[model samples]
Target: MRFIIDVLLTGLAVFLAALVLPDSAVSVAGFGWAIVAGLIISFVNATIGTILRFFTFPLNLLTLGLISFIITVLMVQLTSYFMGSKFDVANFWWAAVFALVVALIQMLLDSLFKSKNRD
Candidate 1:
């Protein structure tokens, strides 16, 4: 139940971020597609992402952990690949921007939920 809710919320963040970006940068077929994109992103981030990051730790150290941003960008591209035409990213930079926006939106949503829980 919790995992499903988190996935849905991540999907909401993805949808919102897509809207915030230019259509040429990031495009989503619909909210339903966004949800599937979210799942793909989450799964990819958790699995392949983790392994890649571990292997890239040396490079990440040199960049002061900023290499993770590249990892995130790649993750977005991988998600797009899984989503096929349902979700599309224009290129590397656009995917980077999209990933950043999605992270920002998800952070905001998480804080909102945290505040509500505290209330």
Candidate 2:
């Protein structure tokens, strides 16, 4: 149940990203694929993103977390590649926008859920 909710949230994040970033595109096939894409994206972020963040921690600190934005761009690019033709984005800037929007939404959702779970 939690996993399902997480996936749905991820999909919502992606949908929001698509709205914010002109370069990003998702299939209109419906919310189901969005959820699947979200699951894949979450997995990629968990595994690959963790490793990247660990290795780039020094740079991240040096840049005062600005490097995180670049990392997010990379993640978006990687996601675009993984989704192939179904999901597309124009450029790194578009990825950056997507990352920014998604991060904001995800942070909000996390905060909401965390507070509830604590209760």
Candidate 3:
């Protein structure tokens, strides 16, 4: 299904982020763990993130939508916490940076998938 593909792409994006960021910023011990963290991240973003974003809509508007990045960073931190040793982020700032990269990758992948679906 499309959801499964999305999760796998998210995992690839996480692996890419781990490779791009400095070792201290983010690290995934293995591909399987990356996939697990990715699935959790996707689920959290779809569920908890939706509620948080809805409640913070005013703040997000005030910040010209930049608050969404903060929300995403928190989601990534949550994923790291839930994943335990499998996924690690040194701190909030590092997690923020990693989240930005992951978001960019996810956006690109989403667009690609959408285009493929349309075709």
Candidate 4:
């Protein structure tokens, strides 16, 4: 299903971010941790993230929606917490960069998958 694919894509994005960012790392357990982090992120994004975004709408508008990127950073940090020792982020700034990379990867993967399905 699309949901399952989205989770997998999210996991892949996280895994890739870990590889590219020195400020973040994944456990030796690897894929399992990545998948778990991805699931947590997706769940939090759907629930808490939505509410937070709604409440932050004014800030989001004032910043021309740049605040959404900060929200994404918070979401990633939340995911990192649930990951326990399985994943780590150096700090808030690092988390922001890491989340941005993951978001970019997810967007790219989604577009690719959608195109493949279309064809």
Deviation (Å) of 46 in candidate 1: 1.2
Local lDDT at 49 for model 3: 91
lDDT of 3: 0.87
Q: Each candidate's TM vs. the true structure?
A: 0.92, 0.78, 0.87, 0.85
Q: Give me the displacement of residue 13 in model 1, in angstroms.
A: 0.3
Sorted on lDDT, best first, the list reads 1, 3, 4, 2
Task: Note the clash tally of each candidate.
Answer: 0, 0, 0, 0
Question: Model 1, residue 97: what's the lDDT?
Answer: 91
Clashes of 1: 0
Candidate 4 on 12-57: residue-level lDDT in tens? 8988888877633433148767878888887888898899999999
lDDT of each: 0.90, 0.71, 0.87, 0.79
Runs of candidate 4 exceeding 4 Å displacement: 23-28, 115-119
Candidate 1 residues 29-98, lDDT tens each? 9999999999998888889999999999999999997888899899999988778789999999999999
Which residue pairs in candidate 2 collide? none
Distance from true position, residue 19, model 3, in Å?
A: 1.1
